[model samples]
Target: MKKIKNKKIKLGISIGDLNGIGGEIALRTFEDERMLDFCTPIFFASAKTISFLLKHFDIDIKFQGIKTAAEALEGKVNIVNIFDDKAQIDFGVETKESGKYAIQSLKSAVKSLKMGEIDVLVTAPINKSNIQDDDFKFPGHTDYLNQELEGDSLMFMITESLKIGLLTDHVPVKDVAEKITVDLINKKYKTIYNTLLKDFGVEKPKIAFLGINPHVGDGGVIGQEDKEILIPTLEKIREKGDLAYGPYAADSFFGSGNYKNFDAIIAAYHDQGLIPFKTLSFGKGVNFTAGLDKIRTSPDHGTAFEIAGKGVADHNSFKEAVYTAISIFKKRKEFKKLTKDVLQKQKRRPASSRRGRFE
Candidate 1:
């Protein structure tokens, strides 16, 4: 990990679906003065797209180009125009031109992240079907990014009060069963455990894993997934000293405040976790990408294309996403500081005693 001086986290933005409310919400989130205090927001879209979005929404925030994060002015918004080519950034109009631009913007943000130009990334919603390239695959940003990073990245629909993590996102119901394996469960739990401890400052973060089948397989009468796959994984993790539990019944887990009892909930599939989750935090929930090398967040909702140019889209989820990214960046910094102090103290102790003398 690259270490630098403690400053506000710089946000690298990907403006998705310029025809939709993505640009509007991104502009609104950037215009907030409080957000500038936490981090400098940098837009990875072009000048034309920015102007089109602002004009469509009729917002009066003036933005300009900046060479680097340090060049961002106090009052004006900072933008890094990434695209060299130009397209008609039409509002309420969806075209391959728009789709291609959206893909380019997202790709540029990923490149910036790899180069360490920004500390965290906050994306607006994009339609998966819109992005049409021969090589472009994956249903959503999370999947595309995870494949790019070449590791397991869990999708968590987040609110401060509760969190729901999906074991399988954007997958067919029939395929979900084949996807759930002991190794996958163990990997996801490890990611959740490490994230809660590092990002949330929880010393012994308790995360519960839910079952894939109805009534948690009811001892294999309903399904064998819980009994054969999930249980063995949970047991192995517990034995390794991770604070994890449950092959809980999917029916009662959320309604019974089971999610409230833990730091995070891991579900068997997408709808299983998100159904109850969205019911609780629908317009307010933020989608977080965990287990990536870079911190990333986005509004859980989509680009309400039907409501484009109407000034009717709710900005709550986008606002929450930006704030969530800032908070995660801050917490990640703290986690690093705490880990460093811990290691330094360990270095001071006798090697033998440090090994045997548990804290």
Candidate 2:
């Protein structure tokens, strides 16, 4: 018998909420022996909590404390323990201790990512209201990435091919209209376009934009945003030689499987895109933070606080999230290589010859 080599993608994960499904799902996702072939998952949490989880769930895996990331084993479970001995976390309670631990884990994971210690990141769902305190005013992960990276970012839902991006996340209904601006729309559209082309390797990506008003305002019969904001944005994208289209009513657009017609859909509000997207893709969609410095993905579902300790919470989304992160990593790198090859070839070709090919 030959001894095969183990090539695994190193993953950095943040324990979302110790009291919720974050720990349980994290434990279960790594329980498989076959996982050693794909990626070496490095979880940033406390040693005590992870041990408690393994015992509580009867999960047969050991969490060894690795002092530094460079010491992580390639084919075994390695943990970077935060050593939070102060908190006695209950199974279902959300105390300040849980919040503090969650924040610390996230901060540690983000730092490791910045240092290029980890190639990709797969995160469990964190409770926004609890983990982030008064000084931390960001709404969720996307905003957290924006603040951390010091740049703009957007959240897009990924369930295989059907991608949906929100124009306004965590905003009230009254403010949704006010948030629709041309510059913001253009910024998000570019993210969607570049992600499809560069990440997914779509030569020319097609995107459909959803409207805020019912029936797309029937030519301003309801609201003017469809004609004023969305339509103009679509036109601009089309002019720039991208296959972008639509200011369709959110109702009919989804009913006809119109979402499948394009590579991604840009929604004008949070629920406008996410509700239908989650409905169609619940337990599968991977929440991708577009326009980030590095690849960051999370399971679309929440922490499942109600089913924290019951061992019934599904790890489907978490598995898919990890798989998606790995797939995106490979695909994007391949595309980047392809782009590099093409550009080098073009630069080496004669100007007249390159113009002839375009012509």
Candidate 3:
């Protein structure tokens, strides 16, 4: 990690579907001048499009137009003119043009992130359906980033109090069981454990896994997946000195308040985790792509076409996404420093002094 001292982190922003609430929320988030004190924001969109949105939404704020992310200045909201042409802004509809522009913005911001021009990335909501073409064939941002980034990507939904991860994301419900093999479970669990340690600064984290069947197979009377697959895998994980527990029934896990007991919860499928997470922390939660080399986060909510240009969209989640990305970036830097210091100290110690007896 690059050492950053006495300087604000550069935050890269991708303007999602222009027809959706992406532009509105991005503008609303930086409307407060105090946000500039934390990090410099660079929006990957043209100044003309932003100006049109600003006028349409009736917001009064000044922003600098820069030709590149490297030209971003601290204490000012910057716009990287990814395109020079004027965009057609359809407030409450998705179009091919909107999709194309959204992809352009995302690719530009990601490129800057890969080149280390930006310290972190907080993306706005994109209409997943329209943002697909020949070049981009993934279901969503997590899938695309999994290929572009170094480490495995886990869709980790986080709030100040609650955190939930999915064992299988963007997979059909019928295929989820097949996807949750021993290797997949081990990989996702290790990713979550490491994310808790390095990203969230949690030490000795305890993770709970939700079951695949109702009542955890009701002692093998309901289904065999929980009894056959999840149970044995979790047992093996625990044997390896990891605090892994449960194939608990997913239906009542959140209702019974058992989720509060663990550091993080891993759900069997997408809806199994996100339903409760959104119910509990809607408009406040952040979707963090955990176990990735680069820091990326986004608002938990998607593009609200109904409320696109109404100026009524809530910016809390987007703001929290920014804050979370910055927080994780700082935490990773600190963790790397601490681990490096520990390794240095161990290397300096003599072999005779390092030997210890269990007795």
Candidate 4:
């Protein structure tokens, strides 16, 4: 990880579908002056689109248009125009033009992130179906980002009291069983474990693994994957010194309030994890992409096409996503400092010495 010298971090944002609630919530989050105290905001979108939304919503905030992210000023909302073409916004409608520009905004933000021009990336919701083409063929943001960073990314849904990670993201239920292999389990577990330790400041996190089938396949009566796959893989993980337990049945795990006992929980598929998470923390959950080289976060909800331009969409989840990204960024920096101290101390020791100490 590279050291950041500036106390005020720069937040890079991607405008999702222009027709959706992405632009609305982003403007709402930065409306408060208190937000400027934590980070400088730079949005990757067209100034014209923002102005159109401001007038449509009757919002009265002035935005500074900049040609590059480097020119962002303190306490000002800087908009980096990625596209020059004009696309009309049809409220509560889906169009190919919106998807095209959404991809452009995201691509620009990703390039800036790789160049170290931004500290963290906050993506708005995009229509998965409309955003697909030859170059973009992923199921969702997590898949696209993982490929871009060349890192194993986990879709971790976060709230004030809960954190849930998915083993199979944006996959069909019919194919979830075949994808839950030993190698897949090992890779996801390692990613989640390392992220918990380094990103979330958990020294030794206790994680729970929810079973795939109901009643854990009832010991092969319903299915045999749990007995053949999960039980044995969990044993191997435990042997490697990670605090992991469960093949717990999904129904009773959250229904009985047992999720509060662990630091994080992992599910077998997308809906298996997200359905419960959204139900419990609908308007306040933040989707944090863990295991990437740089920090990225988004609201747990998706593009609200039906409610677009209604001026009734909630900004609470998007606001929470910003707060979570800042918190994780600070935590990771602290972790790096602690590791650097240990390395420095070791370098000063005698050459003949053979000693080690655990923190």
Q: Of the candidates numbered 2 and 4, which has the greater TM-score value?
A: 4
Two-way lDDT contest, 2 vs 3, winner: 3
Q: Pick the candidate with the highest TM-score.
A: 3
Question: Which portions of model 2 show Cα errors greater than 4 Å?
Answer: 1-7, 350-359
lDDT of 4 by residue, 1-359 (tens): 99977658999999999989998998889888789899999999878888888888887778899998888888888899877966689877889888988899998998898888888999999999889998899888888888888578999998868999988998878999999998988888888888888888888989999998898999999889999999899999888777899989998899899999998999999988999999999999999999888899999888999999999989999999999999999999998999889779888988678454222
Per-prediction TM-score? 0.92, 0.93, 0.95, 0.94
lDDT per residue as tens, model 1, 126-235? 87787867867778899888977645799988899898888888899999999988778867877777777766677888888888899889999998888888888788
Candidate number with the higher TM-score (1 or 2): 2
Instruction: List model 2 lDDT by residue over 64-91, tens digit each.
Output: 6786555678877778877547446676
Clashing pairs in 2: none
**Candidate 2: what lDDT?**
0.81
Best candidate, lDDT: 3
Output the worst ten-in-a-row residue range by lDDT, candidate 3. 350-359
Name every residue pair that clashes in candidate 3: none
lDDT of each: 0.81, 0.81, 0.91, 0.89
RMSD of every prediction: 3.5, 3.0, 3.4, 3.3
Error of 1 at 175 (Å): 0.6
